[model samples]
Target: MNTPDTHSPVLEVQSRRRPLAWLVAIALVVLAIDLGSKMWALAELADREPVRLLGGALYLSFARNTGAAFSLGSGYTLVLTLISVTVVGVIIRFASKLRSLPWGVSLGLILGGATGNLVDRFFRDPGFLRGAVIDFFSLFDPYGQVWPIFNVADMALVTGVALAVLLELTGRRIDGTRAVKERKTAGPGTRDKAEQA
Candidate 1:
């Protein structure tokens, strides 16, 4: 009884609920993989010197960042935790509004990344809400740490935000609707009269 036609329109049913579930699934997966990698890094590379890879362009160095990405807000662990909580909350709110596939992908990445970092912020080290994030991957050493060491979650966050920015520039909304700009038009008679006169 199954046919190709039966499987065709699977992507057509763009309900918000399904996409929201997708978002949650992505978040859980990202959180799991990110945390798992961090654990592996801590166990394997915590005490070792940075291991060069790709001819020293990339290296594995265990770092504990108590602040925002690249240790920017070192003195604001609690504040960053609060901001991350807010990021998670905002993404959850947006999940229920997703109807477009692009929106779903972008929001899912954001949600996943935010949750991944939040887990570290809440349970990694020093104390609650003051724990440091585990960063291990460093890139472009010849460039003098120009890239600022980051983790998988940070990469996801940056990618997601970039996609969102592109979507906004393309006049697409999160609800699967296009923001078409209306242009002014003149009546046929008026246009003709003006031309003729």
Candidate 2:
């Protein structure tokens, strides 16, 4: 059985290196899986029809997307690549500041996903920084064009961002500190006007 954590999140992060490892490990693993799956899709199924993975609900289909999510901004591949590079750079610059588990994991996932796609942008066809990202894995086909086809990297990116949003909503700071609201107390013997009466 797991014991109750008596230490605050910030305290726990400060006391251990394990959380930092978790952040790096998650990023590495996510990057590996995302890229590995993309490689497999490229070699095995690029030209073939969508391979049904689980009934009609999921499929593995090959596509080289030159744009952002849902194939948006298809004409600006280089611009998107530059933006991705900036994002990855910014994330790495702040990687050392990750202290909260949720934030670490969130950033890790985002970093990994960003790196994964960025790799394709660097090396894939159609010249440097203009290469298309290889995506597969279609879902919810029964709904009929309701869900955009995506890949592992995309999955990580979306999940990480969502978790980050939730953490922010609950007043969890990026540095593992809880955002506590300070009560307004009487200061230096000063009192409210009604209390003075």
Candidate 3:
């Protein structure tokens, strides 16, 4: 009697899970960095002047954003919080289907960034779900004159979304499969040439 090959199935399962593990690891690292930076900003930059760097090209200026990234949609904190929560949920649900390394990395960054800001929205000043996000990095000016003040989470989120878009444009999919391109129909001249050949 032949024995069942249980090891093959187990190995296949592990292989499928490897990408998910990578995603989780990347996300945790991003979340930790963003949260830590925000904590440091709140402690060291409070009531202090902006810290200039790169000959004033960059400034670390503490600011509280009650809206989405770059301070957009201000005064709608609750709405933004709910939207973020929904995004996080969708990402988590889709994680189980992740099998491509690039897709995993992109989604991981987005998940981490979203979760980082969500933490602030849930626990920061003012109240739960209405709290503001801590932003400290400013470009060109300390008062966001040239660019909106942002945080690490915003950076990660933007990078992730950009990467995802590039992957999609290049025919990469989340399940490690390249999208099949449709073949062009042969023109009359081409068909005649083929027939002659």
Candidate 4:
């Protein structure tokens, strides 16, 4: 009787290729939504002043931020521009190394957010490549303790980071912990268990 091969190359090919495509698709979708919302905000609120969207709980106001999140380093447009470029480059370079869906989604969110903000910096008013990003979403105290105004892009980035953290913690505990245990129990000659470890 002929012995069946233990490994399937086709399964490996499908596994790797499918997930990578999914990641790229997710990234594109996020970027589309983020940019679309910003465009809508620009058209609706550009000339108008800030307005309360939820009875002072959530406010929609228009302001152009020339800095990173929360308006930090407000005048350092060149610095922010460089940072954005670097982020995009890194995302592209390391996208293939992400081993899980959660990681891919997180990276996609970050990429979309960074792209959205970078678009504003390049295209908004006051100068080319030094334009402020439009930030209108705000959560504030009733008496007007100002929270940092942010845009849709910022929202994506925040959520993505949160997801990435959760995934890393969970993955380490689940798959990684089990693999480590298997290695210790099997000692050295069990090649399959060692590989999994």
Pick by lDDT: which candidate is best?
A: 3
What's the lDDT for candidate 1?
0.77
How far in Å is the alpha carbon of 193 misplaced in model 1? 30
Cα lDDT tens digits for candidate 1, 73-107: 78899999999899888877766667767777788
* Residue-by-residue lDDT tens digits, candidate 2, 1-197: 98767577865656345546777888899999998999899899987877876668887777888987556688899998999899888877876666677777888898888889889889989989999998887786622265777788888988988988998787776656676545568665543221100
Q: Which residue pairs show collisions in model 2?
A: none
lDDT by residue (31-108, candidate 4, tens digit) is 788788788888998787667766778877777788887677888987988888898899888765554555667778
Better of 1 and 2 by lDDT: 2
Q: Which pairs of residues collide in candidate 4?
A: none
Q: After superposition, how far is residue 25 of candidate 3 from its true place, in Å?
A: 0.7
Name model 1 segments beyond 4 Å from true. 1-14, 142-144, 187-197
> What lDDT score goes with residue 161 in model 2?
86
**Candidate 4 deviant stretches above 4 angstroms:** 1-7, 141-144, 171-197
TM-score (C-alpha) between model 3 and the true structure: 0.88
- By lDDT, the candidates rank as 3, 2, 1, 4
Worst 10 residues of 2 by lDDT: 188-197
RMSD of each: 7.8, 7.3, 6.8, 4.9
